[model samples]
Target chain A: MARIVVEVMPKPEILDPQGKAVAGALPRLGFTEFAAVRQGKRFELEVEGEANEEVLDQARKAASEVLSNPVIEDVVSVHWARES
Target chain B: MARIVVEVMPKPEILDPQGKAVAGALPRLGFTEFAAVRQGKRFELEVEGEANEEVLDQARKAASEVLSNPVIEDVVSVHWARES
Candidate 1:
């Protein structure tokens, strides 16, 4: 089986409320050197298919269409590798 | 700086539409031996603080409070390591 990984994150210009909440609490937690925080999601997929080139592209398309929010986020990438 | 990594995933019973879409496409991509697909998110934070015990806990709390969806997901874990 092949495993494909994808990461989804909010755009830099977009405001991530989740990130902001974490950033706001950093000072109380004792880390006082951060100016910002951003939150994102990662997906690992066990692709069931022959090790073909098209498999990776299919995975990417699936991610773009259904896995991530395009308007508020960008820079989604897919990494594919054989199971070890 | 301390780097903290966290992974968030939906509970096993929760249906991941993204995963289902990917699973549905496996045959078209050339593989026909898979039964399911699941997705998750990973976060890497450049925690700016002294390498202290509380720093790690802080990062975890930050993730739990803001980075993950507790209602739909569980098994959120945080990993802390110093920059080499």
Candidate 2:
């Protein structure tokens, strides 16, 4: 089976409280170098055959329409997981 | 500023209900090509200066110790965002 990866991130203009929380905790945990953090979603979709152009297209369509909320998140990428 | 991307995924033996829910919904939404789905997390950590070796090392440490629960998740990757 081929695995397709879809990544979704909060829009730049949107507030990400989860990311902010993580950023705040990092220093306390002794990881002091990072300036900021943004949390996003990653999805792996398994298909029966190759992750061909057609499957990638379908994955992209699914990413935008079903996996992410257009009002707050952006579908940043959709590609074969192995390539990543 | 430079960004480091960290990816976390559920262990292969771990049950991912969220991913299963999304997989179930996909067929109902008319995108029937996918056979299964697994959900994970992506983190973007911003740092000042270059994303050099030292910064990447810190990101890798943070990815495992703070960003993911070692009991259930794995730090799949830690790398410069631009390269991804």
Candidate 3:
């Protein structure tokens, strides 16, 4: 079965407290010369059955509905890679 | 400047409560036959200076620091996509 990966993250214009917190930890982590850091989500799902349009459609719907928060985030892109 | 995109996600064996919550909403959203969903992150950073070893090194450091949490997550890959 092919693995479908989804990435969910806040839009550039949005304020990400989680990312901000992580950014704050950079100095402590020994990182310098960096400005901003944004955070988001990555999902890996195994699509059972044939990778047909119906399955893909259902997967996309599920992603928008349950997998990601579209209100505060955008750029929900899905990629397919071989599982090997 | 190139956009370095990083995708962070919980390990496959790990339980993703957030993804579970989203997967639970699938049927209501018209999705069926979907079993589980795991979630993670995507960061698009405009890397300054020449995209050389130094820039890449610093960028990777920043990613591990402020952009992603390596504790509960892994697969922190950074892809350099031309910004066009």
Best by TM-score: 2
Cα deviation in Å at residue A69, candidate 3? Answer: 3.2
Report the C-alpha lDDT of model 1 over B7-38, residue by residue, as the tens digit.
78888789899768767775676545445677
What lDDT does the true structure give each of the candidates?
0.68, 0.92, 0.68
For residues B1-84, could you state the per-residue lDDT of candidate 3 as single tens digits? 555677677776778887787667666676765566666767665554456667667767776765656777774587775555
Candidate 3 docks with a DockQ of: 0.56
Query: Top lDDT: which candidate number?
Result: 2
- Give the lowest summed-lDDT range of ten residues in model 3 chain A: A75-84
Expressed as tens digits, the lDDT of each residue in A1-84 for candidate 2 is 789989999998999999999999999999888899999999999986666799889999999999999999999889887744
A1-84 per-residue lDDT for model 3 (tens digits): 666777677877889987787666765777644456677777776666677777766667666766767787764676674555
**Candidate 2: TM of chain A?**
0.93
lDDT of 3: 0.68
lDDT of 2 at A67: 96
Error of 3 at A34 (Å): 2.6
How do the residues B15-79 of candidate 2 rate in per-residue lDDT, one tens digit apiece? 99999999999999988899999999999999966667998998999999999999999998898
* TM-score, prediction 1: 0.60
> What's the DockQ of model 1?
0.31
